[model samples]
Structure formats: C-alpha cells, structure tokens
Target: MSNSKKKKMPKGSMETFFKVLRMIGNYRFLLILSIVLAAVTVVLQLYVPILFGNAIDEVVGAHAVDFDRMWYYLSRILVMVIVSSVSTWVMSIINNRMTYRTVQDIRAKAIRHIQELPLSYLDQHSTGDIISRVIADTDILSDGLLLGFTQLFSGIVTIVGTLIFMFSKNVWITLLVIVLTPLSFFVAKFISSHSFQMFRKQSETRGKQTALIEEMIGNQKVVQAFGYEDKASERFAEINEDLKNYSQKAVFYSSLTNPSTRCVNNIIYAGVALVGAFMIPGGFLTVGGLSVLLSYANQYMKPFNDISSVITELQNALACAGRIFELLEEPAEVPEEKKEMGKAAGEVNIEHVSFSYDKSKKLIEDFNFESKPGMRVAIVGPTGCGKTTFINLLMRFYDTDKGDILVDGQPIKNVTRHSLRSNYGMVLQDTWIKSGTVRENICIGKPNATNEEIKEAAKRSHSWEFIRRLPDGLDTVLTEDSLSQGQKQLLCITRVMLCLPPMLILDEATSSIDTRTELQIQEAFDQLMQGRTSFIVAHRLSTIRNADWILVMKDGQIIEQGTHDDLMKEDGFYNHLYNSQFVNVAQ
Candidate 1:
C-alpha cells in the first residue's frame, strides 16, 4: 500500500469537530430541547434504580414485608419507566431532525461552494473525490451526529446524575468511583486518538477508490478495447487492499474501548460492593444503600462505555469533516470589478502575457497579439504547443501572471466575468451534453429563443436533419443511446448559432463532424463570423487557408504570423508542418 501523506493531523480534526458543533448549534431550539429531554429521561431512569433499591429494603422478609411501601415504590418505578420512555422517544426525534437538517445544510453549502470554486481547482482535483465529500463523507457524518447527539448528551447526564445518587448513598464509594474513572477516559483517549489517523486514511483511500471506479466504469469500453482489464483490476485491488487494511486497523483500535472500559467499570463496582459490605456493620452504610451504590456504579460506567464506543464513530466523522472543511476553505474565483460591458466592438489586445500551470514549467510566455474588429484570426499549432492555452487566455479562463489583456479597449479584468464572457460564443472540440431534451440543450444559451430562431440555428449548423428523426424531435431526452459524437458537436454549434455573440471561438469545433457536414458547418460558421471577430484553433491547415491572419505557434511563442499563402511561400517551419499531413496521408 502506498504511504499516505504525513503531517500533524490534530488541530484540523479538532477544529472541524467544533465547526460541526457550531453547525448543529444553528438549530438552537431543537438542540436545547433535545439536551433537556435527554437529561429528563436519564434522571427519571436513574430514579427507577433508587425505587427498586427502596423496594428491596421494604421486603424485610416474606411475611414481614411492608406491603404499602413496596407497592408505592413499585408504582413509582413503573411511572418513571413510562415517562422516561416517552422522553427518550421525543429526544430521539429532535436529534434526528437536527442532524438531518444540519447535514442537508452542509451538503448544499458544499455544492454552492463548488460552483464558485475556480476552474483551476476543478482541473486539479478528481470529480469522484469531490463527489465523495458531498455524498459519502456527509452521509457518515450524519450517522455520527445523530448517534452522538442522542448518546453523548444522555451519557453525560447519566454519569453526573448517577454520581449524585451514589454520593447520597455513600460519599466514600462515590469518591472511589471518581478516582478510578480516569482509567476509562485514559483508555478511550489513547485508542480514539490513535484510531483517528487510521480512519482519516480510510476515508482518503475510499475517495481514491471512488475516483478510480468512476473513471474506469465511465470508460469501460475503452478499457476493454485496449485489453486493460487485468491492469485495471490489479490497480483496483491495490486500492481495495489499502482500504481494507486501514479500516481493519481503525475498527480494531476502536473496538478495544468497549472491553477495556468494561474492565475498569467492574473494578469500580467491586470496590463499592466490598467497601459497603465492610461499612454495613458499623452503620456507615446499610444493605439497601449498598445495593443502590452498586446500581449507581453500573449506571455511571455504562455512560463511559457507550460514549467511549461512540467516540470511534465520532472520530471517523471528524476525519470526514476535515476533508469537507478543506474543500470549503479553498479560495474561490472572486472577481473584483463589475464594469458593465455592453455591445463590445470585438477588438482585443494582449500585451506581454505570461502564464503556466506550474511555476517551474513555463507554458505561455511573452505572448502578444492584437485583433481588429471583424477579423478571422486562425491559431495553428501541434498538440501541447499552447493553442488551447491561448484560447483559455482569450476567454480569461486563466489570468496572465504578467501584462494585460484588453477587450474593446477595456482591461478584461476590469469587467465582471459574467459580462466579459457574455460577449463571446464558444464551441470547443469536447461537447458537453446534459441529460435533457435537444431543444433544452440548444436553447441553453438563448433561453427565451423562439421556435423559428432555434430551428434556423439547428438547420444552419446541419443538425436539424438528425433532430427531426428523433422519436420526439427536439424534445427527445438525451441518454447513452440518444445521440452520437458528431450529433452532440452539431448541437453545441447550434447553441452558439442561437446566441450569435459579438465574438466567436471555434477550437476544432468541426473535428467530430463528417467531411460533408464539416464543409456545410464551415459555410454556416462563415456566415456566423461575418461581422464578428473570430479566433479559430485548428490542426487542419486547409481549414485556415482563407483566414485573414494565421498564427503559427511553437513552444508558447508566435513563430510566424501571416497569410497562409505568404507562409507557404516562405517554406520554413510552417511549410514543413503543412507538408507532413499529406506525407502521412500518402503512406
């Protein structure tokens, strides 16, 4: 198993625990009511043991029994039993409601935070890992919280109330119980503190396992086609084994809390019995009182036992919560400016822009470019040569580390992100199709677009023919069988066509469509770009032959910028890159 990252793990878990407490505290009325009910129930339950001890004292002998006193104590015990039962039930309901609502708020907050998280954060983390936090981790927390509230409050009340009752019977035995009590806490503390890290490791492994399962299942076809089943199984087994080991260790350590504390509890009970037996002859304690002391001793230690066991589950919950707080505390994309950008002129200027995903590895550096209004600027480069990175800069998906990007003579950062992005239409090679009707997907950009407008956009993008064949036409719900790859890309293009913003970005937009459809889509794109400035990122040299200007990029720098014919005439790097495709095609 791979060794997990190591650091001090105490402060974070403790902080998350208190943070969860504060969240539960939000429902002050319910929490306070639950605690009060727990106290009432535990006190009533504690009183019954006293009544039983008094009843035992009343039965001096079979015939000499004080019938009236015995019956009275028994009746009181029965009433206490019934009332405590009702109070316990009511307390459980409040705890459940409080816990369920708190978990709901946390899950909702995580989702809202995820929406605000930066694209960079999303790109760096796995989707499944994030999903685990919102779903699985929160679920574990819900269980822990419900149990903790019900047991923890009542347990403490049980311990305190029992101590008072025991002291009333005999102070010496009560103090003896108190002196031996720290043994149980010492045992619980040692086990819980050690098991906490194991539980944290278990949660982290579970997240990784979920991520791998999501990835492998989502791409099962590719896995099988590439004959990767054996390798995939081996990798999954490794993770599963790691999870099993961590879980086993966590459970083993946590399980010791019950028996270890039970042993100390027995010692306390025996001490009370032996001490009260010796005191009975001298009138320090009575036989009935000795029984009462024994009962209180049992009651007191039961709370410690139950709470110690619950401590393990609480530890697991706190570990999961730490992961959630980690996500919540991440820096979000906070835009500082809100300048209204209305009716952009489609002019953009980039000056000395530099950026890199990693600090040590430079990707884009000293990139300078300018596009006048209504110009079709095509950027061409091999994979990883910063073509998409340039497009990201253009869209401000990433901000430059140095220099400025100005749109319509206004610094891009000076305007709100929503207003800045609203001015441009984007169609990337990778299409995102939600599980919804075709019309719903197409009209997403233009929510109130009329039927005529939607149909015109779909037809121009050459997707209307496919849409009409669906059983429900534009209303067909997209699923695994609903649309093919090319059909999905056409729907994406149909979206941009409906919006028809002031500027356009087409990043291998037609790569999924067939040649005939590509040619038709190109003609449609030409019409779409007629009066708007456009940036076309493409690998097919033929696609950019008529571009007003072509940017030949290599290693994050613009190596050449000219007309296709002019670049071809020069017969340098562009000429060699332009010739290689034909050579590979001939072979």
Candidate 2:
C-alpha cells in the first residue's frame, strides 16, 4: 500500500469506535431513560446497607426496635427494586431493538455501496473477506453495543452511588476504600490494552478462515476432481489452529481481570478490618458504621470487575467495526453521473485506447476500433491477449488509461454507466444462474417480460425443448444438476434475447458446450445478431467465419484484420490460429 493509501485507512480505531457510538446515539432517548432508571436503582440499593446498619444500631443501642419504621424503609426499597427491574427490562428491549436495527441499516448500506463499486473492486478483494465484513462484523456490533452500554451505565451508577454513601457515613474508611480504586483500575486497563490487540488478531484470523471456507465451497468440484481433500483439510486446520491460539490468549487475558480485582478487594478488606478495629477504641466509628463501610468496599470492586470483563467483548466488537468501516470507506466503482445515454445508435468507436492492469506493463498501445450500426465484429485472439479487457473498456467496467470510447459520437465517460449498460447485452463463457425457476432466470434480463416474449426467446435459443421436458416446464427450478453447461448457455442467450438490446457482446458464449449444442446456440445467436451491432470474442475459428469484420488481436494490439476468408488468404496470425484448430480437429 502507498503511504497515502495507508493514511486513508483509519490509522487508529478511535474513528471506528466513535462511529459505533453515533449509531447507538440514534436511540438517545432509550439510553437516557436507562441511565436515569439505573441511577435510581443504584441509589435505592445503597439504602440496603444503610438500613442494615440502622437496624443493627437499634438492636445494640438498648432502644426498642423500630419495627414499623423498619417495615416502611424495607417496603420502599422493595418497591424501588421492582420498578427498577421493570425499567431495566424495558431499557434492554429498546437497546436490543435499536442495536439490531442499526446493524441491519449498516449491512444494507454496505451491500448497496458494494453493488455501486466497479467490477475491478470485487476482483481485488476476496469474496470471503467481503462476506465476513457484511455478516460477522455487523454481528459483533450487536453484542458490543448491548453489553457495553448495559455494563457502562450500571457500573458508573453503582460506583458513584456507593462512594457518596460511604463518604457520608464515615470519612477515614472512605479514604481507605478510595485508595484501592487506582490499583483495580490499573489492573483492568493493563488487561484491556493487551486483550484488545489479541481480540483484533482473532477477528482477522476468523475472517481469513471464513474466506478459506468460501473458496472451498465455491470450487468444490475442482477440489474433488483434483483429489485435494487432504490439502484443503490441512489448510482449514492451520487457520483453525491459529484462531484457537488467538482466542485462548484473548480469553486468558480477559479472565485475569475478575480474579485480580477480587485479590485487590481482599487486601482492602483486610486493611479496613485492621484500621476499623483500632478506630473503634477511639470512639470514631460504630459497629454498624464498620459494617456499612465493608459493604461499600465490596460494592466498589464490582464495577471495576464488570468493566474488566466487558472490555474484552468491546475489543472484539471494535475489531469487527474496524473491518466493516474499511469496506464502507472504499471508493465506489461507478459514481452516479445521472447523465442519460439518450437512445444509443449501436455505433461504438474506440479511439487510440491504451490500457494496462499494472503501471509497469502496457497491454494495449494506441489501439483503435470502430463498429458501424448492425455490424457483426468478431474479436479472435489467443488467451490473455486482452480480448475481454477490450470489451470491459467498451462497457466502461474499467476506464482506459489513454483515449476515449465514444457511443453515437458522445463520450461514454460523460454518460451515466447505468444508462450506457442498459443499451447492451452480454453473455460470458461462465453462465450465472441464481437459485430460481428457469423462467425466473431467463426473465432476469427483462423482469416485466411477457410469457409470450420469454417463450419466444427460449424457442430462439433452443432452450424451450429441454425446458418443456422438465416436470414444471417454465417453472422448473434451476439448479446445477438440473441443467447441462450447454443448457445454461442457452438460457443465458435467451435472457439476452428477452432484453432485445441495441448491441451484444458474447465472450466465448458457446465455448463449454458440445458441437451439437454449439451449433444450435450459434444459430440462435446469429438470429439475435441480425439488425444489432454485435461483438463476438471467441477462440473457436469456426464460430466467427461469417463475421463482417475479424480482428486478430495479439498482446492487446490488432495483428491482422479482415473477414475469416481474407485473413486465411493473408496467412498471418489469423491464418496460424485457424490452421491450428483444423489440425486439432483432424487428429
């Protein structure tokens, strides 16, 4: 990463942390109400120790026990407890609903932003990592916001209220208790800082594990065919082990806080006992006062311990939030320009276009091409010769480093990408079929397509016969096992046919299908190509024999140009490619 890019990535987690706080702030009313209720609860709780002390004083001071007053105070405390409990429950419900809603909004926004990003962005990031951020990271925020807020409010209230009541009853004991506060805090902070780093490591490792699983599932066929089960298992085991190690470290550090705080509490208790015993003879403190002071001392350590335990959880949440924010911060691929293409005329002109994936290597140098309306232009090339890159530039999937792509004399850059793409149809070697019916897959191109229109397109693509044989016909659910590669290609072609786009780009559309299926799809493709400007990218010389123009590309430059017959007569790169295919067929 460049220094500028590194700087752009959030340097510290402070910004991401504050982002979560702001999201939680959306439910400010609930949080404020929770705080008020929690404060009242803590204030009422303090009276428990005071009430015990007063009851003890009554019994010891040779006075008749004030049972009526005792019952009144106890009844008030019980009522406060019930109200506080109800309020806390209400606060919890509101907090959880708000957290879930906020996370949902964040996920939805991330998904929408991801869709707007260019294909190049997806090509760069691992699918697993993106999925992890969207799913797992958002989940982290839920628990973090829930526990963090609950503990934070409750802890602060308890600590403050306990300290105030302790000081009011006795000064020396309060000072002794306050003296141990820093020690507990220091211990919690030490554990928190270390555990935070470990939790971040663990979260990142988990994302990698998720990515590995996704990769395996996506390429399950390849793995099984190659007999890579052992290799895949080993890879997963390594990631799993790393996750286990990091998790153990994080948990170990987090687990230390409670016990450490308790040790400090025990030391404070001993100091209070020894100090109070000496002060009792001096008439400075009563037995009941000592008992109240002891209770406050124990209550004071609880918050510190609570903060310590929840800190680990907060660290994990912060790590997840950081990953999610990083994805959300990525620059969008296609900025919404809002300028319409204004009825494209199917005329595409590429002028002196130069391009490269990496800065050190130039793929296309001064490349130029033009297709008049209704021309069947075939781009034939050896693999890795920038055939797909040419189509990508025409579609504005990636911008050319030097030169312009003009559609009907208008610069494509000036028009909105969505409007520009709406005018063209594309089919790739790999067909994508989502989990839906065959009809749904075909109508994906034009969702509002009529039944007649869909069937007509299917018939033209030669898919209607297979679709009819299925149990549900058009409604037959499409799955990997339900359709052959050729069938899927035909479905994709039918989808494009439904769109009736002004132009079409076919990238090895029939490459995976058998000769019989290819011929059937090719016939349909030829019909679809009529009266539409088409760009055919294919390795098979036989498919593009009748093209109006054949451009032989090598290393992103046109090495030869003409119809197939003309190229054969010229006996150049095109001739070489055509001859090689014939030799393979003969053998």
Candidate 3:
C-alpha cells in the first residue's frame, strides 16, 4: 500500500450516519418537539438578562422602587428560569433516546456490512483494529451527536435571541461585538484545521498500537520461546510515544482557542466601556442600555468560545467517522444476486484454472482436474506446492485469475457462496477448538443434530472413547483444564463428521495425532469415506498408500499422477517421496 493510500480515508461520502438519520424521518415529531423545547428554553433565558438590566436601570434612575413592580419582575424572571430548566431536561431526554436508537441502527448495519466483506480484507487488516473501528469509532459519533447537536441547537438559538435584544438596546455596541466575532471565528478555524490533521494521526497511531498488542497476545507462545519481551516492549513504547505526541499537538491547538477568544473578548469589552462612557454624556445611551449591551457581550463571547472548543471535538468525530466509512465502503466478496445451489452431488471440475496471491507471482497455471462422484483422490506434494491453494480456490475463498471451476456441471461463479460451501466438509491442517462443550462444537456443523447423531459422528471420527472418558461425556467442556492437541483434532474431526457433507477435504487431518491415534482414526476414516468423494492433501506418503489415485505436484503442475503401486513402479517424484518417508521411518 502507498503512503497516500494509507493516509486517505473516505470523506463526506454519503455515509451510514446520514442513512440512519434518513431512517429516523418518521421520528420528525420528536426532533421538532426537542427543537421547540430548546427554542423555548433559549427565549426564556434571554429574558433573565433583560430583566436584570431593567431592574438595574430603575434603581439607578431614582424611580420609586415599588414593591409590587419589584415582586412582579422577580416572579417573571423566576418563572422563565423554571420553564427553561424543565424544557431543557425534556429535550435532553428525547435527544438521548434518539441517539441510542440511531447508534443501535448504525452498529447493526456496520456489522452486516462487515460480514459481506472478503476474506482478504480480514487477512490484510488486524482483528483488533477492525473491532476498534466498529466499536470505538462508532461510539464517538454516537456520543457526539447526542451532546453536541443539543448544545449546538440551543446555543445558536440563545445567541441569536441575545443579539436581537442587544441591538434593540444599543446597536453600535452590538456592531462592535459583531466585528470581534469574526476574528474569534477566523482564529478558531485556523486552530481547527491543524487540529483535524493531528486528530487523524492520533487515531491512526492508536489503531496501529491496537494491532500490535493483538498480534503479541495472539502469538504469546512464539514471543516467550524467542525471548522477545524487550523487543515487543520497545515497539509498543515507540507507538505509544507517537500517539502521545500527536494527541498533545491536537489538544494544544484546541486549548489555544479559549485563551485567544478570551483576550479578544476583553478588548471588545474595553471598547464597549469607552464608547458607552462617551455616549452617556450625550444622552445617546441609557444606563439600562449599557447594562444590556454588557450582558449581551458576555453571552455572545461565552458561546463563541464554546463553539470554538466544540470545533475540535467535531473534527475528532469526523476523523473517527472517516475510519468507519472506510470499512463500510469496502467491496463485498460475493455479489448478492447469484443463484443458490440447493444441494450438490460429489462431482467437481477445475478447468484451465490459474491464480496468484500477487499478480506478479503465479501460484497456479492452467490447472485442470475432474473428480468422479465417489472417488478417493489424494494430492501429494512438497511444501508450497499449491495443494492448499487448490482447495481454497475450489471453496471460492478466492476467485481464479483464469478459467472456471464447476460443481455438478454448474459454474461455481453462478452459485451462492453460502450454498456452495454448505456442500463440503473440510478438516484443515491447523485445527482450532473454540471454548465450548464437546457437544456444542460438534453441533456447530449441524445445528439440529440430535445427541445420538452427535455420538455416532464422534464414534466415526474415533473421538467418542476419549469423550466418554471425560466426566461429562458429550457435555464435557474443552478448555485449558481439559483438552490436548490430539483431543482437539479428534473433536474437529467429529465436528466435520456431523456435517456429513457429500464431499470431504482432509488436509493433513491426522498429522498432529500419535501413531496409535492415527491408526484408530484411519480405521474410522476408512468407513466414513465409503460412499463419499474424498480429497486428501497430505505430506505423509504413508497416508495415501491405499488411495485410489494420487497426484504428485511440483511448482504449479502435476509432475506424476497414478495409483500408488503404479507410481512406485515408475520410480518418479511420487516414488522418490515414498522412499524418502520409508528411509525416515527406518532411521
């Protein structure tokens, strides 16, 4: 990937956030209600300062302070305060509910989109970073939308109402305050632009740190074996330092806005005082008018400073939004309109297939193969001879660069991926046992399988004996306290057996088991393969000795292919591999 590519993220593209908002179109009533409540609150708040100015002017003008009038003004101010407080509380409640629903919708859509992404996407990106983008980045928008939008709506309303009252009292002072407003805005914009880049850098660095930690923890055994604790710690520290530096730069720029705005506000206040002093002598400004102007100045400047602070937070949310959109925009692995294959017979065909991980280095070239409905086909190869790649291609985990693969004479490209995969059972070289009961693991392959069915499958895989020996039998939990590697492999085999797929692919399924276990499992496998089309990719020549057909592979081509006896008589690659294995056994 290029540096430019790494730095670039989807921006202002019609994102899921907007889609979520559109979906809430039916909730317009709640939204409008909140806005009305906020507006009412702001209008009421504006009256408090006006009332304060009126009361001040009345006393200063030597008007007899009537108790009834004084009580009336005080009561009116108190009523407005109560109304504003109640309305604000209501609006906040509604806003929070809307935000919760919106975030839930976003999470659901994002998760579904992630499921549609290609296997290659998962391979290229770290699990932790992807999770962080989905969980953490989405949360930024969720929390920001809740608080930021509410404050923004109310602030704008309050500022506008406050300005109107200030202009009514004394237009000149309001004009002066407006001039200072632009300066504050310009300074804020400058800070925001730099802060945005720093925030983006910070998020990216954090993602890298998350990926590194996940890699270290996932490979703890390798790290311990190699004594790489110091090296890993150094790498983590370097990423941490980069995160700290970027975060500081972002916060430093954000912090400058408040002090800068305050200095400008103070200067404006001084100008207002000087102008008011001159005007008061000429009867152009009243004492009450000056009071109102001062109140408005404070009101306007406070929110302006607040808005400046919020600009940085908005930028941070946008940076997070950009990362999330990147994942949502990734191309899906399989298109949705392909035909679903209900069931498949055992026939498989690979015709003129060619492929490569990187286009520059081809791994399979013009490969062709055909398997009958119930034949046992064993693939023999040295390491890196494209055996696994063939299986992956047949499984459609990847698309071939050239030609086509077909099952039961139907082109694989036209079939739904889910349906195509449902027809095969695969036991890979690296078996994984999830933390669960033995029965749960087996039933995963066939969710509706009965206990009797599960037990029968386990017997077929030679896994039932060990399962029965456990304290809980089929219900026994496979955990660090219970299972071994051989036991895990047996359970994996039992899981595949439960699926009972028409076609089976065993890629070194017995490689991790002991000789005695292998012999036992081999007997079970012999019974299981009776009527199924079986594809075996194995390194052990002994495993394929009884196979109906064996193909010796090299590079991207089959070097020799025949029955084991025929290959042995020919004395070629297959013969050489067989002899080498025998020599090892003798040694």
Best by lDDT: 1
For model 2 the TM-score comes to 0.92
Instruction: Please list the residue runs of candidate 2 whose C-alpha ends up more than 4 Å from where it truly belongs after superposition.
Output: 1-14, 170-179, 268-284
Task: Residues 215-248, candidate 2: write the lDDT tens digits.
Answer: 9998999999999999999999999999999999
Compute the lDDT of residue 422 as modeled in candidate 2.
86
Clashes of 3: 0
Candidate 1 colliding pairs: none
Instruction: Judge candidate 2 at residue 354 and give its lDDT.
Output: 95
Model 3's TM-score against the true structure: 0.91
How well does each candidate superpose onto the true structure, as a TM-score? 0.95, 0.92, 0.91
Candidates' C-alpha lDDT: 0.89, 0.84, 0.81
How displaced is residue 487 in candidate 3, in Å?
Answer: 2.5
- Model 1 residue 529 lDDT score: 97
Among residues 3 or more apart in sequence or in different chains, the pairs in candidate 2 whose N, CA or C atoms overlap within 3 Å are: 117-333, 118-333
Runs off by more than 4 Å, candidate 3: 1-30, 60-63, 140-143, 310-313, 469-482, 582-587
Best by TM-score: 1
